[model samples]
Target chain A: MLKPDLLIVGAGPAGMSAAVVAARAGLSVMVVDEQPTPGGQIWRGIEANAGTARGRALGAPYLSGLATVRAFRESGAVYWPSTRVWQIEPTLRTYVTGPDGTLMIQPSAILIATGAQERPAPFRGWTLPGVMTVGAAQILLKAPGTVPAAPVWIAGCGPLALLYAHQLVRLGGAVAGFLDTRMPAPLAGAARLAAGAVLRSGRELAKGAYWYADLHRRAGRYVRGVVDLQALGTDRVEGVRYRTADGRVEEVETSLLLIHEGVVPELHTARSLGCQTRWHAGQAAYVPVLNEWGESSVPGILVAGDAAGIGGAEAAIQRGRLAALRILSRLGRLPAGQEGAEAACRKALARALAPRAFLDRIFMPRENVFLPDDDTIVCRCEELRVRDLRGALSCSVGANQLKAFTRAGMGPCQGRQCAYTVASLIANVEARPMGDVEPFRVRPPLKPVRLCDVASLAEEAAPP
Target chain B: MFRLLEQGRSGEDAVTIDLDGQPVRARAGETVASVLMREAEAWCRATPVSQARRAPYCMMGVCFDCLMLVEGEGLLRACQTYVRDGMKIRRQIGARHVVPSC
Candidate 1:
């Protein structure tokens, strides 16, 4: 059996940061990812050089990481993209593919930097072809230099939504309005936890207000604030019904609907290893529970990045470096010249962990906004209606109980395509908070592999 | 599902448009997207969902973010066609309110 000094799952900021530190410290490191590229969703810098004007405007912070990513690549750490880690056992797990083909290995340490996902906005016709996520829109702009040429309207809340609007303007696209989804400052108190993090609430809020002003000037007379996005178009999105705060309705017929709530860390792989978990009130999702040192309950396995919780790219990278430092310390390599490195890493990690107050308030998923109307398709996969979720609620069923009964998440994408939608439906129908609802339990084969390859596993077991 | 549609040969003459009354250069066979991209138009479309303003997604016919209004109608994909001379091309904001006539 082959064993390395470290095995990292995911190639985002966190995973790459950890690998760089550990490898530089003379530890063998290997990174495996399911996509063709390394930068996670937030930073999908396509290599074609078909850069957009907005991408150029978003500037260095979004673009600078690639330099670090390039350094990680040249450092000789193994890079395995487009390879899915089907099963991860306590010590060693065999997979049908590596950078080129399937291999098995044991590692002294495992760092998971699996990152975040944008929350779903399940309003009427949101699933239609014209609708997409804010992050997804940025992706379309970056990868293909494409943005809707028609006057596009932006909705939802969060710093990202506005960022997209500004980027659209920078790209020469006209915008209609910025629907502020910020919960009226009264419903709930900011979690004290958000205040205690690395960044100050004042700074984050200031940044958001700055962008809104910039957008206001750039999109003169067009930027309207609304509370609800009623149905958009008839079939594929010809227009949208936006409800103003005064209870008046304005309808704009546009072909696209770019929406998002906020990002939630994808925790499937971390959970597959049985990392201890805790529910994040802000994200409204469960995250792999890890200690200050980034160690999971299982020895040799560590969690970092948004997978630990959405701390942003800077925090994710520092946390990744911290995990490597912890691993090196355990190997009796610390307490010397490494002290300088250790302090630097921890402080960098500190900066990365933004103050939670504003972020917490910014992220907490709304229980009411975009609530699925009756007849709106809740589960995009099975075309399950909101009525179906309501039916389950009448029988006193919840997300977990209903999953086994309805096979909502049994499709090949393995809940990636359906779980959140289902969870939200149940939450809406039952009049409960998302935190109160149980999330889908993630199993192995994080990516779907051919069944034949999965069945031939016995012949591919580890070497004696 | 993703078929690449390449642009054909350039037309013989420069077709023009009064973009908000300023003469803009376009081509006979070029899409509003191709013309705008070759010159000024970059942000093509936005969605009705989150309002994360976006350009037309999937330059192929898949995502309909490239739609623009042609003579009061708002269902044309900018990336999928040619522009005619003197055509009124306005950036699509949303649908105009239609009232029922007595």
Candidate 2:
């Protein structure tokens, strides 16, 4: 087996950008991504979809990924797609399963840019066939150029949902309605944030305005300040019911229900690697703690992109470059006194994240969004409901104990979909902070692996 | 059930797969869940305990609701697995049992 100087875990903006910089600096870099292509979720399938008319119709911001992906491809970095990293040992060794079989790589340094995932928001009938997260719907449109069935009802708050609705409408898909759960309270310091955003990145503000206007133009029934939202269906989603700000209950008949409540850093791999984490109130999730250069508490390992915090794609790219620069300096490839360059990258990252505070304030998920109804399924894997979790919580105080009492996070996902909800529910019941409630322990084979693959691992090992 | 936006716009090669001994039209790069969504009956399987019909919810691999039997691969995620010609897929009825080989 071959060991590389640095191993980049994701192919998103952060990981690819880091690879480009590190490989250009004459360092041996290996980039591994689960997807067959380099683009991670945000830029997924950019290599295959770019320059196509359908891709262009996805809008300008999405097309910007073309240049970064192309640069990574041309950087001479070793690229391995269709590879899943099942485990990363504390000793900086990564175990991955590829087309052939399981392989191990011991890199001198590791960069985990695993990025973000849609925050799980459970509701009545959410497990029904037609209900999916807004991110999932966007993936269908971005990758396969497919749209959900018409009479689609989009619910929840955040920029992603609005952007998806706008893209769907632009792609000639009709949305039946939208349910905005953002509270009616005016965001404080909005003028200041707007000024900062415009001064820093005018193009981003303009793009957001365009998407908003496009969605607004095609809007059918826009319900704001909605509460008690539920997807009503026996077999599949037949309709959605919600209460308006005026306390009026309304129901919209729709075949598809797309829900979003923002995204949080995907922390399973990081937590499994024993990296330090802290609860971020602004993002309403636990984020891996990292230094200015994206280095985690675990030495020789770095965390960047939305994995560190929700700073969007541009900030992720800048953070990736910053981490690469630090790595280059540590490897003695770059000059020692590069404070000026580092400062510039920091400034760019700040500008990129300028609009985040304002956006987070307005789009902060309401309290009810996290606390599911008694009947709502909290754990998608185990089919555990809020009432079930509450029953377990009466006797259990920690997440691990509750997991034992009522198989909440022990399913195929390994707590990916239910960890936050379980922890939040535990916190609510115990009257403790979310941070105090321990997250579920992550085991090897982060994703489910076939037993045959495990048994064939010895035969697939490469000659030393 | 959901359908593609249009024919050529999907930019995917066409392929056919067998779903429970029936032919289903699907694109080469499309997932099994995509094909199931386009069908009249969108559901892929029923839950083991309650026998409740379930379809692909997250579309991504996380939700685990889109499990199906693909070519004797036992239960696999329909959303993650891409379609191929002559692929034999069956609806996952309940709990999956891995039969041991001698």
Candidate 3:
């Protein structure tokens, strides 16, 4: 068993930044992440690849993460790499499993920086091989410096989609085409957000503009307002079909199909800890309710980074620092009113999050995404189709009830991939507000734990 | 279906791992899912419910779509598991056969 003043349950931008701040302030900090290295999905494998040719090609945004990773390594915080924090009890006793086996830790405070997962974009033949999320492809490129040999046809629309397309081109990978599924936002609403973004987040806006221009310059076919997207294949994705903006359905041959519709805060860890959350209509996801200090509804528990909302890495780092300052003050590590960095962190965080509203409005998921066709597999883990869920919707009122009736979310994934879609379907059928359809009730053993691991913990606790 | 970029092929040591009783070469630091993606048969598992073939969706841990039987031990997420020298990997079909707890 281990005891630390604070236990952070991820090693991403937020977790690493938080560990650095808290440890420097004389609070014993420990970060446990499931990756082999400290860089979470944002920097993925920065330590090994940061100064290499691959890093230079990955561009500035990724290279900027090297400094943070270096600071975290030198910060005296204990980092347990390749460790999974499967459960956190209300008592603040945390259980984690790793290469060494299972262990328990009791921490004074817990910070969940688990971050975000791509919004599940289910469509026909999505389960086939060679079809994956754009984020997955980026991870592959970062860690292993690999790319699909076949030209990739990217679908859906978001900043990540364009950024990845540009990165793929930069890495000498060919893009078969880009099928943009974004619908034009109302000019008034979009303009209002754009004005704020330009005023506060001009740098981020400039970067997106660069990627957009580079992608258009390099991509062969750029199809906008794409609808009814589907991958075509028997064993693996061999082609894709989608209706173009001009109302013509086009089919293109491509072995790889990448999709993205932005990311939503990962909710299992927060939900399991019984934190309160509400649906964010703008991002179209459930985000945990948190104060400016990053403290959640539950005292002694804080959430930072994309796990709280869809703020990207820069904002996540700022939030992590802000959370650490609050934790430090709460624990008396810092004398009262000496927290001078809080103001700077808040300003940087606001600026980092400025572009989000405009991006969210412009890249919001199209209406068709929520209404996956009857034949589409809503639950990839349970292999449940939309029709199967619809059959159970009549007898169910919400996501939890639908799960009990159809077992749509009862597989190894525990509903990470399907919860949003299932809840959306239930909301549409039940004619209830999206917020009324609560997500699945997350249980303990957040990650699948081996029975032997649990038994080992029990034996260790026995009187010797 | 996937190939290592220029930097991936240089400097990194290569190791061979067995995939479904066949030998395949892989980079040392690359994950089992990355190695499997380069193989012709990319699907690593058949769903327990429908027995339909599935491959790695999210290269991260959240999506358990990359489950594979390694060394006949149990089903492990290939995306999370790194490729090692002579790691015996097999496509996990249907429900995982539970190994007895000792």
Q: Which candidate is the best by DockQ?
A: 3
Could you give the interface RMSD of each candidate, to one decimal?
Answer: 12.3, 2.1, 1.3
- lDDT by residue for model 1 (A18-95), tens: 888878878888888755567765566533331544456655567766766777787678888766677788765535
Task: Give per-residue CA lDDT, model 3, range A343-370, as digits (tens).
Answer: 8898899888888889999998988788
lDDT of 3 at B53: 86
Task: Sort all candidates by DockQ, best to worst.
Answer: 3, 2, 1
Docking class of 1: incorrect
Better of 1 and 3 by DockQ: 3
lDDT of 2 by residue, A408-437 (tens): 888878898899888889889888898888
Q: Give the TM-score of candidate 1.
A: 0.75
Error of 1 at A45 (Å): 2.1
Task: Give lDDT: candidate 1, residue A400.
Answer: 65
Pairs of residues at least 3 apart in sequence or in different chains that clash in candidate 3: none
Q: Summarize candidate 2's per-residue lDDT along B1-102 as a digit string, tens digits.
A: 665776853445558899999998787777888788778788998887577788887776777789998885668788878888889899988777767521
Give candidate 1 regions above 4 Å deviation.
A46-55, A90-99, A187-207, A220-225, A331-335, A369-371, A424-436, A455-459, A462-464, B1-102
Cα miss at A71, model 3 (Å)? Answer: 0.8
How does each model score on TM-score? 0.75, 0.95, 0.97
Ranking by TM-score: 3, 2, 1
When sorted by lDDT, best at the front, the candidate numbers are: 3, 2, 1
| C-alpha-based local distance difference test score of model 2 | 0.84
